[model samples]
Target chain A: MTSIRRRQVIAGLAMAPFISRYPLASKILGRLVIIGGGFAGATLARFAKALEPRLGVTLIEARSRYTACPMSNLVLAGERELNQQTFDYKALAEAGVQVIQDYAVDVDGAQQRVILQGGERVEYDRLVLAPGVQLNFDQLSGYSRQGAQDMPHAWQAGAQTTLLRRQLQAMPDDGLAIISVPPAPYRCPPGPYERASLMASYFKQAKPKARILILDSNDRFSKQALFQQGWQDLYGDTIRWQSASNDGRVNRVEPASMRVHTDFDTYQPDVANIIPPQQAGDIAHRAGVTDSSGWCPVESVSFESNRQPNIHVIGDAAIAAPMPKSAFAANAQAKVCAIALVRLFRGIRPEPTVLANTCYSYLKPGHAISIAGAYRTDNGEFSAIAAASGASPIDATQALRQQEAAHAADWFSAIIQETFG
Target chain B: MGRYHAILPMLVLGLTPCGYAQGAPSALSQSASQAAVCSGCHGKLSGVAVPALVSDARVLEQQMLALRQEGGDSAMHRLIHAYDETQIRGIAEALASQKNPPAAQSTGP
Candidate 1:
């Protein structure tokens, strides 16, 4: 053969094997099972299914409907309705996810299967947990399941909000209202403070003399500066924030009596919002996926639990910081977790992941405040990478507040749409 | 032709059976041939850090979808994104049919 032809022949011989190998790669990928239908589970399901139509996805949600906790407090202040924050399982179905409206009884990671409360078994190659927060009501004395019926914390975003709304509407002018804020490291760190601010805005109108006394267990809080400025400008002296050292700090609540107290005095209020301590949900610890601290310990960057391989943790149940326990943070972590899951399946190493979260609190119709941060994994730890990430100025002008309010609503809507829609 | 070598592995990956390429690739019609491909790369400090596919077809499918997109997760986004749907599912089933060790060690959460 000629020299050029000989070179071509040699290359063709090598190419023959590859031409033959290309048609046989269709039937070898792994499946994934995700628990909890909240932001983490829902977003993960959509993204994964969209990417690979054949990857088997089954989302197990304990409840039929998902009520967004991000905007639930707005229901109390009458800014949004209950329906606005609610969603069904239809979206997951559209994305080819098998949606099970059942509770997860046990995760036999060893068996590579999940046992449902109804006794059904579903297997998975990998598992993702977004089981959300478990309120530690037991940590606070005198707080019971029944007590929440009368004194609603409105923390879980559905009926609790409605109950609180009804109680608020029933109060007459000059009535006293008490809101108890939990200590640090809870879901949605700024939630309780935002609730207080929104409540103060509501009280400023209907019953101007109605006092809102916030009894905080911690001295520092979420969106402290913005909430303070909002209360000062909107409700002025009508709202009082009492920290742990304050005389009116709340130790406990007598839900039935509608009473809350501190060292020096007792107040019988028309409404009491008693938010309790929190921890990872039962499903996480029950699987031996968490340590004694009641939180799931995981590799910070990949967001994978240290307790088990093939089981990844996200959202309120997992320890991902310095990101707050907000929906935005959970959504960001889900993206990183998805990438990790994919790389493992494909026999490729995953590139380092960088995640970002910005939480905004709306003070009123057009006024808003926000906190922003970006994070990445370094030396196997997920830490805040953006040193300048922080909240909007406390005494922000109305124009700045207006701009933030618009951006905040848009961000919230885009994320919710990305997650459940 | 040499440039195509890099892309051919992905195409041949889960196409016929797991490891039907002792010489070059061949059409592995029997379940036994498929099993042979499955055992080739699964288990014991396997290159993939994920739980060993261990021939668990059902588990394979779920993880495939979980890693497919951003919400699905970010750790393996680019690699998972590389495969087409059928290839992903095929790999899930092929690997799932193999026997995994009692426990495969993993490095991530």
Candidate 2:
């Protein structure tokens, strides 16, 4: 064969696994069970079936509908609705996946069974936990589950988001609103900033005299420059950001008086959105996969729990830094995990892996910024390839912002379909 | 005794035949799995101008190779740099070969 033809032949073989069709055998392989029907687990359940039709994939989710946190800020701003962000599992059920509505109380790695809250045990050949994040309410001095009802964190969407919205709407003109951001290694690094922008957007029109004070635990945040610039140009003195060095971190909260106290000062605001510290969800700990950091340690390539065999962890629950815990990251990790599980069931060792993340933060309606990159794992350590990642330029035109905003919306739809459908 | 007879009962004990049928482990394609990751960003934008990968293999290859050649300290470059020419070609072909439903595009942000 000619040299060019030889290279082509080699390339074809390398690509064959991706393109080749497996025989449609209606036979059993093994039972694959997934906990949490969010971005990672749902996508894994869907893709596993696509890869191997006979793989018995069962997804256990406590909630009937998923409200995407990616664009839930829009819902908070009234630009979108909760119903719009919410999605049901009918599509997944139609695809032969057994969707169970129950909380996974415990995961027994030895027996490979997930014990539901109602005392039923479901068996699995492979168990995947994509339980996302659980808020560390104890991290803050006076913050508790009940305290959240009064001073909404609104981080996980649903009721808290609506309560914060109502509070913002009820605030009188010239009222001060406080937003407290937690330190790093949190879900969606840019999320609190996005919420601040949307709240500012609503207040700008509704109560022009209202002001927002952002108390950040970190010295810096994602897209800080772009977000700061947008605040300056658009909101104009309505939003003020304090870095951690300046006592920007909130040390305590007085929910009764609606006051948040920082290291340097205290602010009595009409509305407060306090995003507390976060860790892996409950099931990861129950599965005995979480490490000292309260996050699951996984082999980067397959996302299999480092502490437990036959169980994989993905999304915010996994310790995949350099890669932020965004919905997009979860979706990408799910695909990799699904394929790895499929390969393992067939007794084939999974290959080295590549993953990707594209996080878009809307600074305001019809304007946004994004950071995108690809990741690879070597010897179980994950690293982002800087050459393949980038952020939108700081000095972007309005037209460009509009285009990016459009892209952000399109991405949201795509991801929902990819995960749910 | 036959060699297969020794493990027969173990197979019945271990494998649940009512669920997913077990078969000899076959290697899954790395390119296909990686391409599935791309749909997170590039696929399903109905009216948005994302470079489509599902329609053609050569287009996907050209864009990926171009990004790889246009070397900079960018994230996309670093991502592609991790893969060899063979892997890139495989990914492009895998994306092209997928016959899944076209992602429903969104008209709003």
Candidate 3:
């Protein structure tokens, strides 16, 4: 669940322990069903399996392979192949998750049965939905689903990465590459910024005269200082950003002319990447999961949908702000969810939850910066745990940024090992 | 009754709003700082996979002790093992008073 701009990051964990079957072992709990076998879904399934070998685990994945949103930008930038970002469900299925290669169309969470698009229903004692995100193409005129064919979103990963890469390569040496970034409350808030930097990584060498323009709807963005410094040092004059201050906010766009409409005027380009406003997937809406703000509000601690009692929603779809929607946050959240679910299995009361998130993004090369925070439930709403949980300092030196990058890679490996194979 | 006995020290902790200590704030003693450090790693406090401390003094103490000993030579020993018995109790007590909030309320079903 990722967009070219806001990539979806999910984390899941499963813990399974075998029972010697002392008579009443047959009376154990019902099955657990997880939807959207991305990071969150897959990690939970594995963790749940680790927790209880006999506890049935079912995973509904629309596709067989997972193209991670975390590093997909590397693919689009031609730094890495799609396979590098690609993951197969074989490892997850090998872990005892009853993997289904089909779309989960409806979740009767109240009844704990997930209904597929093909009229198949899978029952569960507990349900987890991490369907990732659905793009809001409607925000920009003329960029329909078909329009994405010529201009790939590459938001969801896999072939889209290839398509976007090809488009970039096909652009003339001094051509224009305009990518519009949607406003806040989107997944991987710093993603569009990272994509810009990574794009510059390629364009700098191949199309030295080509320019990479980011048309941001908002004035402020995640890791702002770091991005600015990176663009200044790395791209020099080749990369540009138009924030709300410059009246550079994109209001709409016409697909035919590859033209984008900002507050003042219109501009056409050789290539366009329009990441429109985003909302939770339609399935979440159909299941009565969202609030008036077009996002899900849960118990703030359990991430249990305020709209539904039994179903839990994690990942970018949930409004777990004060903690931005990032892979680290989702991973933190899925673990909490896994813990609570385990306690529920034994009929134990769940304690209050405290969550933390640290997101790192590099401008380019060895430079990296981060924002870190801790969150806990306060008065039924998730708020920062305390300001004591500080943000990373600005303009860190090369060695420090390099260390952060090293840690970033370690974190990814440790997290992937903990969540998935 | 045992839970109460373990929690009774809090009435005597006299941990003021801020630093009661010299190096660290009296409010955040060595024990408190250590607790903060511990949470830096294991403090996800997620209600699902991890339990929220949530007004449970006895449970928090037991959980802390169990987790501390669960991993022999754990990387978290700096916080978990740095404090004495009373200090450990203080950290667990503080965490207990805290409530559990979902990471995200997830309005969407």
Candidate 4:
């Protein structure tokens, strides 16, 4: 940790020449306000301050504590606890970021101020919205916030995670649990499948007769081949996955009866996890940054909102195609945005950047698979570098899978430290 | 020393010359920003399986270039293929120049 601090100091010192190049930058005392203290916003706030201490960075988060979504599936499977997934903004605040525990109700783009739910107006020289994704319950018929209490989506990873876990615990030995997956462009593309895998593993011990059914709205998922191989090798017939083309798109939910309706049939499962389709958080829409697709469009390099000037969007809120909305992707995007913002403040063009993402999914305890890709800005959009992108081989040995699982755990620990520790 | 060594000359020829000249201060700064991406996984505080990214520039560069040429489906191999020799060298130097505390322990998984 001392070395990390020393490296941060060196990074700060290395920026001296760039600041000296623009005389005004040395005296610039700009305010950078970021909304949502999740992976992207918190990382951006810390990195921006580390890069330029003079920049007054403020992070506005609604929740006093953040519940991470990355490894929350393990919580549902009784492999991990919810507290392990929860983090606070103390470290970020200690790093000189003004952590505001208040909800941002609206953004006055013209006035360059954010109106909080507590009826306070905070001004900013540059604003960033990293509000992650808002679960669009309306997109799924008969599913509302109230309905989610009965059939927990568990997507946001706190109370809902506990709710789902309790439901699984209460289920009978031979009961069936259904995981309804939304379409693509949602946060954590491979998440629901991992949930199924872990739940199957849990049931293999606790309720060996129980089964899992994945009703996916997409035809395919991230790391599909490897996940299928793992499912076959480990879980056998314990888990069943249905794609959208096979009438797997969940259209409605009868939460009172715990039934999920698909085009061909209705599943009256003992437990239901309905992950709803999503869009940018409400603040992005209020800020007029989101397009008709319900996600904010941004320039690939700086993540500046295409709709509004001086307001950047990162993480799941931004339409960074070819970059899945994983925690690692969000972290990488936040750093790139921080670097771009620092250079922009000094009147230097943001350098061309290479963004990378690696997502690991546990198939069972001590077994996992992964997918990795590197992306670059090509013709004003984010494009994957084909030569550098692939998933784990289907024929990987058990030892390799165990090693990947270890890497997965290490990755979660490392990213948690990078974001909050 | 086969196809991996054969691709070295082409990779060198395709290098971006301006920001990556050896020992250039600007190169360090630029690569520092780029290397921030690595912190998401390869943090300073090493993990049980993932090693802390504290190594000499030459060693780091050689490891990355070799991973790129090995052409496997492993995460490191896939990610390492993203950079050319110059960018890899810059990132290597930037990470190598960081001061590692004397007590920092090195362990293998």
Candidate 5:
């Protein structure tokens, strides 16, 4: 939640109640309603309370538990269990955030209310929407809701993750496994590659004769050089990747036949993980907050929807380009949004926004790669400060790679503790 | 909008140096907005190999200035540009103050 700064702001606000200048308005800051209680919503709720205990924050989530998509790849490779990635709202509730176990079916932006599936209406002075992405299964032929049951995307985690893991475990020693990656702006840029790396690791250990194939829609991917180098060092040609320029775009998938059709050819595989194209969560569409791009456009400083007033969007759903859609990015955005809202409640102008993200992808158990950046919205848009943004060096020492692996583990623990601990 | 209009004068006044009491130690008492961004990746909770920002304000400021001057499009150069000297000073002080008063343990919300 960007604790130190936020805490100071809250502390200062306490000392000088600027809102008190308006004698008649007792509570300038009233209720805050947040939808999709994942990283963004949960952190927003907690930070709002920490900044100003009197501010009423309510988080509405459809699911009982949230299994983070960040480290779920480790689960797919059987390196980590789905349980390690699972989180609930118990801690948030204990922190005085009214966590509702219900689906937010629609948002009445004008009325400032979130309508639930149960017909109950939750109203607020401000609304925050952090619904993650929704996979567009229709983009791929022969892939639908039911098809996902057989060949899971595992993009949203939980059941799909477990299904993919089980599929990998059941494949024969010499079986071929394919991971079809969609075009850019997908949930996690490095995810498919990381999954491929871990898959290679798993196969190298369990199914020595097994080969892992990556069918990608993009010409190049995040941390490409490092990933290629690691694959060569660890599994050699056992892991093969075909870029879009080389017919890597998978046009169709026949789950029934266990085959995927690219532009140039079709290949049958023992198991396939097809991550489809994505859009903002369903509710964003209902609220009319998304643009033609299928993402919610937000004012850089406040993350407030440019289409709708007082409704802010964060996380993967938000079109905060240059900042990849990641758990850390969402966590950083949540704090900025929370701070902006607090300042607005007190009738103060929102401060300049500064956001950052550090993403780590493990190559093997002891080796990892990372990309990091610090960003600011001085001109009302977020961009990586050329000086402050970069990925792990190409020719890093083995010791450095191992150190980064430890950092990755530490980052995971720290974020989880900060968000839900 | 009307409420915002009513508070502008007060906000302008609050920005004055007199708004805060004199000799109020900067570190623990400074606004955390600028410094908090660093905490996202470098704090005790973040667990990365990067050193925590919990150090003397002067020392932290020098490091930030170095990153700003010599970081050269690196992540360090980009992140440090978000603040001016005052903001950086505030951040360094806040982080320094927190070093002694252990960070709060995160538990069930």
Candidate 6:
């Protein structure tokens, strides 16, 4: 055995008396119920069970199959199929987690029970909510749940992804396609730009005369310099970007005529992807965990809800600033939370933890850029470790971009297998 | 036995003086949890361009330390700066000892 293992053994022996004196040492740990079966919830369920086999874990998901959002942009560019982005919860269920296929209507935190749509009440000693972002269609004028069908957001992936791809395919050779990006604090910071890049790549090959425009509500974006440099290098003059200061903040849309309205002008593009504003999923509001910002606040170490006790929030729904709402961040948060919950169940004080995230955005097929950061809990909040956080260099070599692209594909495959497979 | 082996290390770490005073997790637990994030990219499947986390502990620690000081803008270099030598060593040891690591690679989608 290694020296570390030997130290751990000695440490364990020293703690034996303290372990015996612990109040809950002999009793069985109660149930742990998680809502949403995405990266955060599914990973938490599996890891929590693996850590403590005695803890009963149940995963509740509204949909039987999940269409991942990370790689869905590739689907729009015809580089990937929607089926490739989809997964079922059979693997999670097979891993000894009781998987429930039903909508969680409300969470009764006082009673530690979750109410399902069909009147089923699932009780839990602890609960985790990983429900991702919900688009706020009401925030934008001339847009609603129905209007999204015509002017597809394709933000959540699935049918809308297909709709946008089909519309792009049907457009004329010289047609214009406009992608409208919402303000800051959206699901994925680099997603809209990645979509714009991939779409331009598609139009470059399929319709050489086509034009693509990006209308941004924000003045700057994540990896802006790198994306601008890539646009200049890969698809010059084919793509144009307008910031909010340049009248690019889209406030209205007429899906019937494919018209998008900004502060200064109105353009009728052949295709429009209007990504609406977003908030924590509805159940978080119902659970009384969300603050006025439409996101849940939680203790950084444990991810336990600040508004309600015994309820933890992770993933896109939680206000994990400095850590973008990406699949990688959610997966890391889930593992830390699993560790915290396991200790808490055993009547042990939870430990402050560290988390990391890496997001890769493909500039084109076999070419990609990336951003990475590490976060640590300080003074009850998560702050970025400045020395260890940055994006790919703007002047990166083509070889490095290609390698990062392969890493991006590898990342998607690894995360999919870890979460669903 | 495997399960206990994993839990005992964490338990001992949690109760140690360094872990208890400031509520800071021991380097072992912190590194073990942080290592899970690596699985999001470096899986043990074939056809993967990213290297898997299956290196010798000392070599992994040395390489990570070297990368941290290299001061490049690559993702690995930037991320490795977050960890100190102790945590890096802990991560290397934890990953090296894992019987079943976190992730696996497959083909597209």
Top candidate when judged by DockQ against the true structure: 4
Where is the poorest 10-residue window by lDDT in model 5 chain A? A16-25
TM-score of 5: 0.84
- TM-score of each candidate? 0.73, 0.85, 0.74, 0.87, 0.84, 0.87
True contacts kept of each: 0.00, 0.47, 0.00, 0.43, 0.17, 0.52
- Clashes (backbone N, CA, C under 3 Å), per candidate, total 54, 23, 67, 0, 18, 0
Better of 3 and 4 by lDDT: 4
Off by over 4 Å in 6: A1-27, B1-28, B43-55, B70-73, B102-109
What ordering of candidates by DockQ runs from best to worst? Answer: 4, 6, 2, 5, 3, 1
Worst 10 residues of 6 chain B by lDDT: B11-20
TM-score attained by model 1:
0.73
In candidate 6 the C-alpha lDDT for residue A360 amounts to 91
Query: What is the per-residue lDDT of model 1 for residues A341-419, given as tens digits with 9 covering 90 to 100?
Result: 6666666555454455667777765577777665656577767754425667766577767766655554455555556
How far off is residue A73 in model 3, in Å?
1.6
What is the alpha-carbon lDDT for the whole of candidate 2?
Answer: 0.75
- The residue-by-residue lDDT of candidate 5 on A1-421, one tens digit each, is 2111223334556554221111223553578888988878887887776666667777888777778887788887788878888887777878778777777898888977787775566777889999989999998989998998877898888889999999999999999999999998888833999899988989989999999889999999878998998899889899999999999999999998888999879999999998999999999999999999899999888888999998999999999998889888887788677777777766777767567788889898767888777787667787777655778887888876776676566556556665675
For residues A1-421, write the lDDT of model 6, one tens digit per residue.
Answer: 0101222334656543211111233444768989999989998888787777777888888888888988888888999888988888877777678777778899889978888775556778899999998999999899988989889999888889999999999999999999999987888833999999999899999998999999999999888998899988999988899999999999999888788999889999998989999999999999999999999999998999999999999999999998999898987788788888888888876767668888999889889899899999757899999988889988888887876787677667767776776
Error of 4 at B41 (Å): 4.1
Instruction: Please give the distance, in angstroms, between residue A302's alpha carbon in candidate 6 and its true position after superposition.
Output: 0.3
Writing each residue's lDDT as its tens digit, candidate 4 over A241-303 gives: 999999999999999988899998988999999999999999999999999999999999889
lDDT of each: 0.65, 0.75, 0.62, 0.77, 0.72, 0.77
DockQ per model, Cα: 0.02, 0.20, 0.04, 0.29, 0.13, 0.28
lDDT (tens digit, per residue) of candidate 2 on A219-310: 98877888899899889989999999999999999898888999879888888889999999999999999999999999988888889999
User: What would the per-residue lDDT of candidate 2 be over residues B1-109, giving only the tens digit for each residue?
Assistant: 3212221111111111112222312225776666667643322222324334334567666666776776532223345565778877776666555443435233322
Supply candidate 4's per-residue lDDT for A393: 87
